[model samples]
Target chain A: MSKLAHMFLLLFAMAGITYLIRMLPLVFFRKKIKSRYIRSLLFYIPYAVLSAMTFPFILYSTGNFSAAIVGTAVALIAAAFRLSLIIVAVLSCAAVFVAVLIL
Target chain B: MEQSPLKFKHGIKDGLPIGLGYLSVAFAFGVQASILGLPALFSTLISMTNLTSAGQLAGITIIAALGSVAEIMLVQLVINSRYFLMGVSLSQKADATFTTGKRFIAAAFITDEIFAVAISKRQAINFKYFIGLAVLPYIGWTIGTVLGAFSGDILPANLQAALGIALYAMFIAIIFPPAVKALNICFTVFSAALLSCACYYIPFIRNNLSEGFAIIICALVSAAVAAAIFPVKEKDNE
Candidate 1:
């Protein structure tokens, strides 16, 4: 295969695999889960998953420890107030920028 | 399931910040594609099709290295597997109005940010609101990819680096509010954080485990433990 065709082939494979992973459960698993244990577990998955992804990773995300720390602190405070997602994200990014400049 | 008063308009409004965040991250991806001698069109196409950051990066690396088609599929499956869990969770969150066709359409756009926002809704999301929520971020990601491919390094390094934290901050925002009100949720989040830290720090696990698997392990273990300890008496249909 030519280079461009090869790239397209690879892209399609990636897209196909990803779409399958996302699409299957929603399409087939429409019934409400019966078990309280399972339902509660699902409820907690989002928080648990997001939390794991954020910390330690967030510390290294900005490539500067102090900036990331500042950003995280601002995000925690802003989130505690139940601020909108936009505001909290913007505040975090802005805090990281200012921290980067000063430190 | 409680009927959500939210409509397409609310989705658009909620999606704006997510779109803004995607733009910066997609821009970085675009620049990486450009560095690999790929054109702006290709990078934009990848963003349009995949709509994911880490998966796209891994895909392109495999492509550049002349890896096989099987390698592409396997790597993407491993990296993007989190979407499987998210899909299962969101499937339960969707209202009756979220039919087969709507689920099919909405499933294509289930990124981490989009899933987080959708799951955070107090009521079950219907198809219209979910689609409305998805539009802007999709466009923003595509546009950002094109811009990055064409105008590489226009933004200052500090600003771009700062933007890197935007998605994580949004994640924090999503997980924190409910945490304060419920002690169980607080414990779950804290436990997941500790487990994740262990995955990051322990040399054996750090070296052996991929980022994607580490997330799955931490989330599943913490959530299962929490559920066993504090099972909800009734499922909150909200």
Candidate 2:
């Protein structure tokens, strides 16, 4: 299959799932979720998912292992300081660029 | 209950910062899309249709890995499920003006930032305000993607490689603030990371589990375990 066609199919599936998840609940369900387990699970899911996606994979992101490590460290520190997403991302990328140069 | 032009203007005013923030992250996504050899138009369309950062990034992985349709659908379901909660939460904030038709229209705009801004409003939201709030960010996100996709082609190889970490950095920025606030969240993040690391390293598991599936498993297990252990109080639920 063509790359464009494949991408479109994936996009359609993603868009459809996402739209339904948001729209169905908003349009039909007015009640707050009652279960504590579900609520806690929901609260924690984003953090967990992000963590899983970020680590290990991030180490491979920059191609250079040392550069990626530098980037990850910078990212962690900047984010811990409560920096905005843009600032943290830029700092991390900048750190990697420097690491690539020096090493 | 009537939708007022003034309120719509206020919504646009509120959305500006969010639009600005989306620019950098969306640019990273665009770069990643280009790296994956996706056309700029499709990358922009992903932003236009999805309006999400993590989900789109995950979609890129699935596409790059040649994951099946069911895989993408399932991954999107797991990753974007937070929107379900946001949508349900925002439903209470909608005034009588939010008719069924309006609800459908508004649903497309219910992003994390948009929902946060909408829910924080003192007054109940109307369709006009919601639309106004979503427009600028949508435009910003698409524009950023376009810029990134085009620029990725011209950037030096070293620089493009460095920029590859941009989305992951954003992910760290997102999870860190919350992780620091609560001990349970800290544990959840680390455990998920460890699990994901294992998946990446272990030969047998690594060979069998696709990237999408590994993420799904790690996230669900870590979250479920944390939820069972922590069981955040009802009022603490966000």
Candidate 3:
């Protein structure tokens, strides 16, 4: 197959898998999912997901330890102050880029 | 609270800010997809179907890395597992009087931002507002992807780099509100950053892990540690 055709097939399969994961709980667990403990656990999932998503980016800019340290410091300060999302992210990226340049 | 026919109105109102924010991020994804050599139509289609920021980024990265179908599926499953919890949380906020059709529609639109706003209302989520919230963001995401894919071809490389800032900005926005008063949140975020950096520097660990998996591990570990040390007291049922 051509490269385009290959990409199409891969994306199609990926979409199918993604949709199934997202839809399964709503469909299969509709009637079976009635518990308070599970509900409480669900509340924490977003926080967990968000933290996981942000962690790596703040560390290891361009796969370097020093840049990661600088980036982490900047992100922590911005996050602590509750700065705007755009500001913190931009600051972190800039900090990392500058740190890599200097160190 | 008084019942209003403008239920969907509220959703639209709440969704507008989020939708605006989504436009830039989704546009970046579109550009990335195009740069990766995916067709413009395919890029837009992915955005329309998925409507997720991190998931789309992961999907594009995995595809670019030439991961096998099995690997892609596993990644998607793991990355999106959190949605199951979100869906269940949404169910509690939903009205028992709502029909299956309504639930399905609402479930389809249960994004992180939408869920946060809906849950904060502490009322039976109005289907109208839910639909309203979904509408603009959906359109913005689809259109942004298409536009970005097309524009990626013509945009200067420097401009593209600047546009990339939008995604990070959105993350900062989400973290800012929660961290304002909470030192523990700050510490947890910092710790996760440190851990992620260590994982990156360690050749064996870095080679074994994908970004999605790393994110899940870091977030859960940091948050779990923070929750243990700084527990929130719950109100007793009267």
Top-TM-score candidate index: 2
What ordering of candidates by DockQ runs from best to worst? 2, 1, 3
Q: List ranges where model 1 is wrong by over 4 Å.
A: A1-14, B1-43, B51-103, B109-137, B144-152, B233-238
- Per-structure clash totals for the candidates: 0, 0, 8
The local distance difference test score of each candidate is 0.82, 0.90, 0.65
Top model number, DockQ: 2
lDDT score, candidate 3, position B122:
52
Instruction: Show model 3 residue runs off by greater than 4 Å.
Output: A1-6, A9-48, A55-83, A86-103, B176-180, B220-238
Give the range where candidate 2 chain B is weakest over 10 consecutive residues by summed lDDT: B1-10
State which docking tier applies to candidate 1.
medium
Error of 2 at B30 (Å): 0.4
* Candidate 2 regions with alpha-carbon error over 4 angstroms: A1-3, B1-6
TM-score of chain A, every prediction, order shown: 0.76, 0.93, 0.66
Compared with the true structure, what per-residue lDDT tens digits does model 1 show for residues A12-99?
A: 9889999998999889865556778876776677678778878788898788999999999999999999998778988998999999
Give the winner by lDDT: 2 or 3. Answer: 2
What are the iRMS values of all candidates?
A: 4.4, 1.0, 4.5
Q: What is the lDDT for B43 in model 3?
A: 88
Residue lDDT tens for model 2, A1-103:
9876777888899999999998998899988998889999998898899999998999999899999999999999999999988999999999999999999
- Per-residue error for B65 in candidate 2, Å, reads 2.3
Which digits, one per residue and each the tens of the lDDT, describe model 2 over residues B1-238? 3343337887798899999888878888999999988788878888898989999999988887667899999888888989999988899888888898899989988888999888877677877888889989988898999999888888899999999999999999999988998899999999999999999999999999999989989999999999999999876665
